[model samples]
Target: MFPIVSKLPDVGTSIFSVMTQLAQECGAINLAQGFPDYDPPLALQEALARHATTPGHHQYAPMPGLPRLREAIAHKTARVYQVPAPDPATEITVTCGATEALYAALAAVVHPGDEVVVLEPAYDLYGPAIRLQGGIPVYVPLDSPTFRINWERVRAALTPRTRLLMINSPHNPSGAVLTTEDLESLAALVADTPILILSDEVYEHMVFDGVPHRSALQHPALRERTFVLSSFGKTYHATGWKVGYCIAPPALTAELRRVHQFLTFAVSTPTQHALADALETDPAHDQQLPAFYQPKRDLFRELLAASRFELLPVLGGYFQLARYSQISTTESDVAFAQRLTRESGVAVVPVSAFYHNGHDEGLIRFCFAKQEATLRAAADRLREL
Candidate 1:
């Protein structure tokens, strides 16, 4: 057998995969991964079905994306963010998902020996993707109490070798939304550095508490250098569709498309058409998501109030982080998660897994993207602990 690539040899099964498997075996309520059990809007589903039978949609879409979808995205961007509409031809490229778009953007920009700064605990994909491109990932930790970035630490991490910075807003596992001040700070830090910014805004529609989602595109200086990536899956509850788009300046978009064309060429044609329809006509669906999910969040919090776990503040996304220090003496987050799954019949992802050094502590992440009954059942079971 051929020897494996040494760069990624240390990477085994993902924590999500392993925890989900354990969750299945234990018949636990799986809150390990961030995917909804509920179906997407019936209108989107109907559109998909209609497109499947409608003539010409079955063929491969244009390399960038279907023109209608790109135009719809442009309109949506202008309507929601007040940004000028992107030229569908030169400034937009659709990929298999935001994952693919992220990968492509990284590959296109990062060179050998380049330093890419990523905030920790980051999404698992960022480090591996950087490593694969021969770029080093410099992780800056965001510990608790504030979960905000230390600007001084971020400045210290930058060097002449620094090429890009990957940031996620409405962040995963933490439910932290980047504030306007945070974006201004980021802009100040990267102003003279020639560093590219990849802003993952997949959960853009999920902000709560009247907080407006701050997009990199909304910042004038950041917009010039930023590649903004968003997923239709997260917005529309259609994770399996795997249709996502990226917007960038023409130059950056060109480079990303070079990698994207070879990666997936294009996403499924019919789904693109269906998403176009959703973006154009059913925009209200996503506009209401924050209100829709807030009740679930409140319900889950209410249910878990009596439990030993202390729920952290959730600002956005489907995730809620909780500290279990009172329930168990176990210091290891992974062990605590495993024990919870086996004994409490509720599966959660250990927050420590998001850190580079495997931070074993009392924190775990729960996905609240379940049906009300599911959330209630899981919360009830968790109360027994």
Candidate 2:
């Protein structure tokens, strides 16, 4: 029997897992994790059921993904980004999920002592992935109240040892989407730098209020030096399907697949077939995503308006942020989240959990990706405060 040391000693269960478990334990309306309570599109579900019985789909897909799925992704990319379609065979690799793609991307790029710059209140996975590869993570806090990036601070954070910059738009917890100006500024900043980008666009199809998602793939220079990742689960409201894809330059794709080949080898076969059919059979599902989620975001905002929680502007994505400074000035974000779950019977993630230092901003994030009944039920519990 050998004594084992933990690689991620500071890491335990994720906040999403922790809060969701607590919500279940307390019999609360679970809004802590960003997942829909609704089913995926009927077309996709039917495709899955049909494909599952098909002979070839029961086994492994291509290491790069099912070719049909890759081709469909390529077509979608060309249409949305208005850029040259990446050769599906050489540049696109289907992943287990966006999480695995992101992990594989970091493993492909980062080496010992390298630094990866991250914008905070970032997704929790970024820092740990960097650290797992023996790399340093430099945190740059997005400006409070608005969670928008400051370019000067970003510029200051980058140095010669900086190997990667991670960007998440339609950001988790805050729902901040990157603007065109932000992209142009990013392109200018990285123009001469050797740094590569891991652009997390899982929420790509979910931008709201007529604002474009400004994908890294849309900028020629940025596209050349980036690994762009997105999720079918997000597009079709089937998150448990865990199907995602990565598009990079041929060389970068080669490097990522080297890591990804060992990481998961391939995503689910039938699910890939289902997503391919979903993409090709009805492009409107992705096209109408913003419209689909905007009303729910609005509904949540409207219903929660009377509560002591201050609603933050939701530019995109399914999550909403509520400031609790008005509700309770004493408790840390973690304590408030726990207490809120226990007393109010609604669970929300603490925004501070996304920060490395646990930098409390007196904010909690609620997942509005729920049923109308669930949203109303959660609001009913919350407004009683």
Candidate 3:
């Protein structure tokens, strides 16, 4: 074999993929990955079918995106956040998915030795993507249990080398939602600095209990400097579609597009048209997300209430974290997660997978964005524990 240098020497297969594969091999209900077992809304499926058969729609979309799609996104953003609509021509760039948006954003802005502050436990991709760009990831751990941001700790993490701060609301793994005050503190933190914000609001519509998912774009101080990313996959239950977008100021969007054009010049043309149709025809789809998902969240929680797993509060997002100390203190989270997959006939992601240093809180995360029957069956197996 040729001698090779690994960009991510310490990284291995993602826990999500590993656990999902284990679930498949074990014939277990897979709640480890954050994707619904069910299909997307019928309206969305039909739109795709309509466009897929349309002549002349298979060609490449504009480098930035389909005009109609970008316009639809801008309209949705302005309507949902009550902020001014971003210029579709200059401020939005559609990509393969939020994953690509994240990579492009980091590659565009992060130079070698620049420090990017990331809150942990973060999405598994955040650290690796930052590292691949030769940027240093400065991790600030969120408050445990609630998983809320600690602004003072974030403040302490900043240095003259800090180029960007990455944040996620309706946060992954923890389901913790950021409040308006949290955004205020963030705006104040980077007020005088040249630091940029990367706000990952993929789970924007999934907040429960009447709590709002605060976007950095909503704040005047942070809006221009923030790259707000949202996922069509997350919103439409079409993770396989791999479509998401970035909304930033024109200047920032230009930089993002410089990298984006080389990465994936244009997203799937037919998919973009379908998405545009869905957005315009079924605006209620976005509005109904909370009511649709909240019931699943509640039902899963109620079913697990009597189990040995101590369920944590899910303020937003679809994942539910449960402490398994009552079940086993001796087993590491990874071993327990694996054992549970093999023995209990259910799969989960150990919370430690999200930490840079493998910090285990004896907690495992369960994705609740599944069909009611799937959740109930998984809950039945879980209750046996």
Candidate 4:
């Protein structure tokens, strides 16, 4: 019999999977996972079908990515951030999704026993991926009220063993966007350290209430050390397509590609071609994302106003966190989510699942990335609770 590695034994089934299964079994409205229950742009879909029939796009794309797609990403970054365009041939490598890009980046840079600093409540992938590469994940909790980083806590967590910092904004589950001042604070802390950064900006276009989305590439000092990861799947409402890219300085990109080539080698050819077309010809698709998502968020919030749950402040992303302390004395978030799914026919993810220490916060995360009627249906069901 083979022995199993014990680094990730504590991590078993994900909250998303368990809640989704319960939702299916109970015939409940699923608002647990972060994927949209809507289709992507029609034009992009048509382009993919058209490209599939074309003879030229049927073959494998280059190891880095299709040249045109890389160029389109470069143009988009330059236009939005006022940054220099990276060489498509050298600085961009497409991966299966932002998930794979994150894994590849960590694998390429982290040595065994190296400490990778993470911001929590973090996406579940970051900790496991770091551990799989034999690196330690050091978590610094974001303070409540604002859910912003506590700079003193962050500085205290840093040591000579720190090799990388993983950050996400506008953050998932919390809906907190990092401000320019926050970026400045990060830059100052790592200015003299040998640490690199992996910035997950998958929800880049979903900022609300006139708050601008800050890009890691926009900060001059952090640019060289940062590997900015983004997903076309999230931006285009096509999560199943699973196309994402990473941008970094050539020196850092070189290492990213070394790991990327072995881990999927290339993304889907037709999707890459179609995404290139979408990026070049349809800027309006991403430009209109906030308006597209804000109404659903507002409607969900409006519907929840009559319920016992108190809505937390939402700044970005398709998720909204709500405290359920008033509804029940049950302090366990996992138990609350399961009960809500079974009795109320509405499913949500426990917020405590995102934290490393697993502190029960009496909170749950509900995703609003669904159609108007879907959001309305989930809200209507929650009103009875």
lDDT tens digits by residue: candidate 4, 110-178: 999999999889999999999999999999888974688899899999999999998899998899999
What are the per-residue Cα lDDT tens digits for candidate 1 across 1-385?
9966587887889999999999999999999988999999999999999999999988999999999999999988888899898889999998999999999999999998999998988889999999999999999987574577888899999999999988898898788899889899999999987999999999999988898899998999999999999999999988988889999999999999999999999889999988998888877777899999888899899999999998999888889999998988755899889999999899999988898788665789999989999999998999988
Query: What is the per-residue lDDT of model 3 for residues 238-307, given as tens digits with 9 covering 90 to 100?
Result: 9999999999999999999999999999999999999999999887788889999999999999999899
Lowest summed lDDT across 10 adjacent residues in model 4 is found at: 140-149
* Residue pairs with backbone overlap in model 4: none
Assess each prediction's global lDDT (C-alpha) against the native. 0.91, 0.91, 0.94, 0.92
Deviation in Å, model 1, residue 80 alpha carbon: 0.7
Runs with alpha carbons beyond 4 Å of true place in candidate 1: none
Model 1: pairs clashing at backbone N, Cα or C within 3 Å: none
lDDT comparing candidate 2 with the true structure:
0.91
Q: Candidate 2's residue-wise lDDT over 1-385, tens digit each?
A: 9999988999989999999999999999999998999999888899999999999888988899999989999998899878899999999999988989999999998999999999999899999999999999999999988989899999999999999998998798788989888989999999988999999999998888888888998888899999998988788888899888899999999999999989999888988988889888897678888888999989999999999889989888899998988889999999999999999899999998999999998899999999899999999999988
Candidate 1's displacement at residue 111, Å, is 0.7
| Cα lDDT, model 4, residue 117 | 95
Model 3, position 252, has a per-residue lDDT of 92
RMSD for each of the candidates = 1.0, 0.9, 0.7, 1.0
The Cα error of candidate 2 at residue 216, in Å, is 0.8
In terms of TM-score, how similar is model 1 to the real structure? 0.98
| Cα misplacement distance, residue 258 of candidate 4 (Å) | 0.5
